[model samples]
Target chain A: MIAVAQPTTAWYLILAALLFSIGTVGVMVRRNPLVMFMCIELMLNAVNLSFVALARDLGDIKGQTTVFFVMVVAAAEVVVGLGIIVAILRRRPNATADDMAELKG
Target chain B: MELFVFVLASAMILGGAVGVIVRNHPVHSALSLVLTLFGVAVMFVSLEAHFLAAVQVIVYAGAIVVLFLFVIMLLGVDQSENLMVEPIPVQRPLALIVGVGLAGVLVTAIVQARSAVQTGTGAGLDNATQTGDHDSNVRQIARSLFSDYVFAFELVSVLLVVAVVGTVLLSRRPARLPDDIGATR
Candidate 1:
């Protein structure tokens, strides 16, 4: 069992997969939009981990480069998404995603 | 040295993640998530990805989790009062089966890949003999970012700016609350 410690890069990828899936479940189970957003970030982070691991394995900088792009998009997502949530909350104090099911006022 | 660090960090990170999911209170979960993020950062460091480790702590634990806690407080969500008393639905069984199946697949994939790596597997491993100007993993990363895929870098920066503006618009509310729907005129 001690031999299990030295994981190949594939282990990291699998770990990333697990993390992303957990985030997906979090999004499904958690009712709060804020929590959902956090879960989404968790999913994005898992991908970053995958990119770094694979890049190292391939002996190339390409994966990390892709990760950088993903990071940028993630940053933007948080800024915009959280801002929108706050705005919605401001308008309707308890603005949950579950509550906003209607198409029209 | 490597073996010790990996084992300890992985155990801690995995445990923290479990704690976060098991805890019912949002505050407890958030705090456990912090531990998870920190543990993940340590794992990143072990993987020779220092930059990512830093980002993991600052972005995930420092900023993101803090923002989450703030929201929880602001919303004043009372799980005790607001908790759904519905019976154990189909979701519980489904979630369990899916989660366990994914874990099994992952463990199998990992075991397979470990047996497949060729010699001198990772670039991050430091060799004292290769002492030249280009000696660090960070330097290698910088070289790649500037040399190739530079266009993607610039696009991401633009995305950040757009996100900032969009967030403002999305969160903003009218200065005054109009009680009547027709009062906006």
Candidate 2:
């Protein structure tokens, strides 16, 4: 009988780092506000994965409980973010992030 | 079994992430994000964070992605953008370079220090068995949340209410056009 080594905590952390980098690239390269928003969601999920992994490693329930708070915050952020996107699109149809230069001084 | 599940979930997560970035249409990107979210939920379950896995599916895949689709439909910006067109020159290349660099640094750090970090402490699973109570993960989480972290929990509720109000105020459309302002008077 052969014993297979299980995946380690470091593997989870590495996966999270990879996911975070992907989200960062998406946010930078994608022009659409909605897509950028989705990328942000991806980034948040990656962070949540890290939290859960650490919680499991450390035997702490706090980390898992914190995931709940993070989820709530993420939901709120999506609502407000999408509302802003909708408002912008309502006034200017098919507006990309580049077109919103009104904030540039 | 665990190693196989981890590999499968990680592949799904990374594939979905790439899909979200590479897809030209917003709807496709949103669907890809759902895949990524589900993969994360699966990872949570494998980590023994069952409560978080459930919440990830319910709140993220269920509610948050629905909100994303709602806005995508309402805005009607489903048309695919030109991938070849670069509104900002050098943005894509720069992002790729930076992303690859970041991933390299992280992976290198983990590889170098892998042995120092302990694995399989089993504290999470131990909490349930050591006491002989056979309490579920959710119950343990509830005990910590309601007792030790009660104040922060209440604050999150308040933040949610504020977010709801802000979204309503921000998305409200004008009842009448500006040109109608003078005609009625």
Candidate 3:
């Protein structure tokens, strides 16, 4: 398997999946909005990793294009998302996400 | 050769995942996320997506994490003792059920995705006139963004501006509340 192409993409995909799961757990279990935000970034990166792998595998630039769009979206998302998080922290002084269920009731 | 680097990156990624969840302190969790981003960036490099790798570092590690830490510092007190942020209130059973359900779905999806693998011939990577080899390829990316995706980029700029204004507005305390007699004007 030294000179073989092998199944390298599988490893990347599995890593991405694991990272995605971790991000999900952080989102589900953690209370802090900032931490939640970080988890969201983690999830997005996991997607990005898979996109690159598929891009390389397909030999087309499309997956890279998708990653570029995702990156752009994520950057935009954080700027606005953090701004909202700051706003929330100002009012209730509670940065934990579970207690932020104002819209739930 | 490749296997060694892959192993190193995988270890780092898994360790970072552990730190992000297991750490009690929020600041420590952020540091763990930094580790996670580094691992993802390295993985990006390994994938031969150099540009995406750079973006991962600058955007995630540099910008997003900085904003996260800024929010953490702003919310919590200077000392750790004063930073007793309250825990989230939720039914534990419900949370566990939902989390397990989601994980099951995700694992299934990953396994299905793996079944569709078709290894590349690897030659097409070296030859593409649309995106010329190596250095000039980045320029092609920029050109594509400006020509094809320019409108979306501009929209993002506008969204950021609105966000800035909204954030200022949302955080600002009003001069008076109904119950307050001596609220600052």
Using TM-score as the measure, the top candidate is: 2
Q: Model 2, range B1-185, lDDT digits (tens) per residue?
A: 89999999999999999999999988898899899999999999899887788888999989998888888887788889888888778888899999999999988997888788665553454344555665578888898899999999999999999999998877876666635222111
Error of 1 at B173 (Å): 2.2
What DockQ does each candidate score versus the true complex, computed on alpha carbons? Answer: 0.40, 0.64, 0.46
What's the lDDT for residue B166 in model 3? 66
Best candidate according to lDDT: 2
A1-105, model 2: which lDDT tens digit per residue? 569889988899999999999999999998898999999998998889998888888777888888899899999999988887887777778998888777521
Candidate 3 deviant stretches above 4 angstroms: A1-7, B77-108, B112-134, B172-185
Chain A fold similarity by TM-score, each prediction = 0.90, 0.95, 0.88
Best by DockQ: 2
Over B101-124, each residue of candidate 1 has an lDDT whose tens digit, in order, gives 776786677677776766344444
* iRMS per model in Å: 3.8, 3.8, 4.2
TM-score of each: 0.80, 0.92, 0.79
Q: Which model is ahead, 1 or 2, in terms of DockQ?
A: 2
Q: Which stretches of candidate 2 lie over 4 Å from their true place?
A: B118-135, B178-185
Scored against the true structure, residue B38 in model 1 reaches a CA lDDT of 78
lDDT of 1 by residue, A1-105 (tens): 455457667767777777767776666666667666766776787778777777667665566667766766776677766665665555566666777677443
